[model samples]
Target: MLTINNLHARIEEKEILRGINLEIKPGEVHAIMGPNGSGKSTLASVLAGREDYEVTEGSVTFNGKDLLDLAPEKRAAEGIFLAFQYPVEIPGVTTINFLKTAINEIRKYNGQEPLDAAQFLKRMREKAKLVKIDDALLKRSLNEGFSGGEKKRNEIFQMAMLEPTLGLLDETDSGLDIDALRIVAEGVNQLRDGKRSFVVVTHYQRLLDYIVPDFVHVLYKGRIVKSGTKELALELEEKGYDWIKNEVDALEIA
Candidate 1:
């Protein structure tokens, strides 16, 4: 569903993503594991078309279209959903209202009619129940005064509602406790239909325990240094990243 080739991106003068290449097929989930400052989140932002990071080289194709050529909203309309590491708080905008507007906007983009209030409410209730989010929470301002877990759950709720073809989760596990992590993961798992794909960026393997990626990739120095099955995540958890670092450093020196 997504193909990234030799992707290099930079924020101003400092380069982050050096050469990221990966293919995400339909129905596959790929976990990107890396130490701090390894450009894991950068890759997600680049794919989401965040303006700060300019793509220096390479191309990203999503369903045969040039992904990099599209704007951020365009990317979303094209079925890309990015769950931020830290979801922003928008005061004065109720979660329900915000999502209704977003959903209608996406529908308009696709030349479809917007959902009326009753239709929207039904869909909202279904998604909220699927994610186990409280109705009171959605009535309040978006992420305003919500706990870390609530914010993450809200992100998953958004993803569920959008039904994106590809989901890019950037450190969704960060700051989440075990209960919150499981809830979020379960919500994500529910959305894993046979045709949707996901790229989960995380530093630890705990998230993988629940999400259960089909492929695990170790990213270092902005490139994918190793790729394997879920066993790779277990290996990283057991041995840590220093061994991988040593191996990559030795190859560079040689």
Candidate 2:
């Protein structure tokens, strides 16, 4: 569903995401794990069409179209959903209201009719249950005063509501306890129908325990250095990223 080839990106002259090469087919889940300053989040931001990062070289194709060519909202309309590492609070916008507007806007972009208030409410209730989001939270401002766990879960809730073809979860596991992690993973698992794809970016192996990936990729210094199955995550957890660093250093020395 998504192909990134030699993807290079930079922010303010500092290169990030140097020669990232990944290919994800439909119905597959790929986990990207790396340490700090490894360009994991940079890959997510570039894929989501964040304007701050400029693509210096390389190409990304999503469903046969040039993904890098589309704007951020256009990327969303085309079925790319990015769950941020830190969900921002919109103090005045209630969750339900914001979701309503977003859903309708997405539908409009896709040439679908907007859901009526009753239909929207019904769908909202259904999706809310999927994420274990309560009605009280729905009534509150978006992410405003929500605990860290709540904000992360809220991102999953947004993903559930959007039902994107490809979901890019940028460290959704951050700050979440086991319970909150399970809640978010269950939501993601519930939505996994063997047709949608997910690229899960995280540093810990614990999250992979819940949302087991088809492939685990080790990213370092803005590039993917290793790819393997879930067992690779376990190895990384046991041995730490130093192994990966050593391997890359060996290759460079050779």
Candidate 3:
């Protein structure tokens, strides 16, 4: 569903993603894991069309379209959803109203009619239940004064509401306790409908224990240095990243 080839991106001359290449098929969940400053989140942001990162080389294609050519909102409309590492607060906008507008805008972009109040409420209720989000929270300003877990759950709830074809989760497990992690993971798992794909960016293997990626990739020095199954995550947990760093560094020196 998504193909990234030789993808290199930089933020004002400091390169973050260098020579990233990966293929994400329909129904697949790919976990990207690495130590700090390894560009895992940068890849997610680049794919989501975040303006700060300039693509210096390579290309990303989603469902046969040149993904880099599209704007951020265009990417969203094209079925790309990004669950941020830190969800921001929109103090003036209630979560329900914000999501309603977003969904309707996406619908309008696709030449479809917007959901009426009743229709929207029905969908909202269902998604809220699926993600275990509180109705009272949705009525409040988006992410305002919400706990970390609540914000992450809200992100998942937003993902469910949009029903995106590809979900990019940038460290969703960060700052989440075990209970919150499980709740968020379960919500994400429920969205796995055999056609949607996900790229989960995380530093810890514990997240993979819940989300269970089909493929695990180790990214280092702005590139994918290794790719394997879930076993790789276990190995990383057992050994940490120093071994991988030594191997890659040795190769570079050689």
Clashes of each: 0, 0, 0
TM-score for each of the candidates: 0.99, 0.98, 0.99
TM-score of 1: 0.99
lDDT per residue as tens, model 2, 105-127: 99999999999999988888888
Clash total of candidate 1: 0
Candidate 1 CA-lDDT value: 0.94
**Best candidate, lDDT-wise?**
3
Local accuracy of candidate 3 as per-residue lDDT tens digits, 55-101: 98999999999999999999999999999999999998999999999
Encode model 1's per-residue lDDT on 85-180: one tens digit a residue: 999999999999899888988999999999999998898989998779999999999999999999999999999988899999999999999899
Predictions in order: lDDT: 0.94, 0.93, 0.96
Give the winner by lDDT: 1 or 3.
3
Q: What is the lDDT of residue 224 in candidate 2?
A: 96
**Model 3 CA deviation exceeding 4 Å by range:** none
Could you list the CA RMSD of all candidates, in the order they appear? 0.7, 0.9, 0.6
Q: Is 2 or 3 the stronger prediction by TM-score?
A: 3
